[model samples]
Target: MTICQNVYFKLKKYVPDDPPEMGGLFGGRNGVITSVAFDQGVSRSMCSYTPDVNRMNAVIEKWNLKGMEFLGIFHTHFLGVRTLSEADKKYIKQILNAMPEYIVQLYFPIMVLPERDLIPYVAISQKPDVLIQKEELIIL
Candidate 1:
């Protein structure tokens, strides 16, 4: 998957250190990520984040106005943690289930602190053919 260079820097700026995992929704055209909708901090902890739904929905509407598609969601993982946790996986499924039938897939990137690299994945939302797998992250 491709991402804008600015998106990388923006995510970094949100989480300079560790502990409180920062995250938000990302948007773009086609399949390339070009914009981000940083969620308002509703409830964030060292290992979890609850997106501000009102803020997120508002951002989505704005992106729609700008002719961009909601691409995916991203969240940070503490240092030494390089993969999505069980809770994270569960949430991904929940998100997928919530999506409209036409929105087939969503990208999910885990930002690892200190290391500062995004490990990306794609989750397919088609029933009876559901899947979740790693995606090559291309930041440019």
Candidate 2:
């Protein structure tokens, strides 16, 4: 399994939809993604609401049951703001501080303009420094 394969599988799960605005854990096998966990903020943001601490904890527990590691945090960037925003950086730092044991992965789903196309863009660092390329997608 290579990074390409991991990205393909991960992208497959969220396509053909409005795209989720959240973060979660992911498990990669031989560099291939095997599982994904969408963050709590996703649903909350959908309804223009905020998530409570307890709710966030519950979402984490749900992912824990799946036995996947915190691969990264992913959220949809509407309005073409594909770059990691200041708020995104802040949250990443907070998440890292709160869970220093795991090497968390970060992702940003860029929903292309008027068309509302969902493109899976990912970065591993606090900033959008790394862009997962299409060639990385392993045919598998």
Candidate 3:
């Protein structure tokens, strides 16, 4: 999947000097990411990101009205953490399983500070096992 550089820049603005992760919803059409929504600070921390489901659902509803599909989520990791932690994997599984039947979830781990780049860490629940892939994240 490809994400617009505009989206990356938007996320860059939220990078914190200290811990306390920040993230928000992303949206686009037909496999191309072009829009992202980050508002203040939803509900998150250094090691976890659990935004208000009600508010997130509302955002999805609003995006649907605009003809954009929900394109999973993006969040910043704690400083120096370039890989997803066990907690991250668990959360990814939970979110992927909770998505609507037709929706395939994707999660991007945006590294903070010294290593500022969005890492494509996709999580898909494939029946008996969950498949997580670290693939190329094209920033256009």
Candidate 4:
């Protein structure tokens, strides 16, 4: 998996101090991430972030037009906590359930830290036993 440097920088710039959690969608092709859609926050606080559905849908439509595929979702977390929360797990399950059969069955739940390092979670439908696990991130 490859992350475009521009996309990474944009995600960092989207964070607002008050909410402390900012999120968006990433678009890519052939497993290489190319673009990011910084979402309009509907409900967000220090501990949580929620992307407006209309905004998410709009981003999907816009990126689809550009020939990019949905690469999964990304959000920021308070520094020092790299593990997926219960809310994260629930959200991941929901995302997995709603995923289309034709689309990729894997979802990469990424946690962006204040230090600018990415901590990624691995989740694949085929391996239910290990639904989410932390893994090193590689950005290019």
Model 3: per-residue lDDT, tens digit, 1-140? 58888877877766665656666778898867888876334454546665556777889899999999888777677665677778667767877777777776565555555577677777776854678888687888
TM-score versus the correct structure, for each prediction: 0.88, 0.50, 0.84, 0.80
Number of clashing residue pairs, candidate 4: 0
RMSD of each: 1.9, 5.9, 2.2, 2.7
Best candidate according to lDDT: 1
Ranking of all candidate structures by their TM-score, best first: 1, 3, 4, 2
Regions of candidate 4 where Cα sits further than 4 Å from its true position: 44-46, 106-109, 127-130
User: Model 1, 8-69: lDDT tens per residue?
Assistant: 88887766474677688999998899988776346655567656667776887899899988
Model 4 lDDT-worst window of ten: 126-135
Off by over 4 Å in 1: 128-130
lDDT of each: 0.79, 0.46, 0.71, 0.67
Off by over 4 Å in 3: 39-46
Judged by lDDT relative to the true structure, which candidate is superior, 1 or 2? 1
What does candidate 4's lDDT look like per residue over 19-73, in tens digits? 4576778788886778877764566456776656677767878888988787777
Off by over 4 Å in 2: 1-24, 29-32, 40-67, 102-140
* Superior by TM-score: candidate 2 or candidate 4: 4
lDDT (Cα) of model 1? 0.79
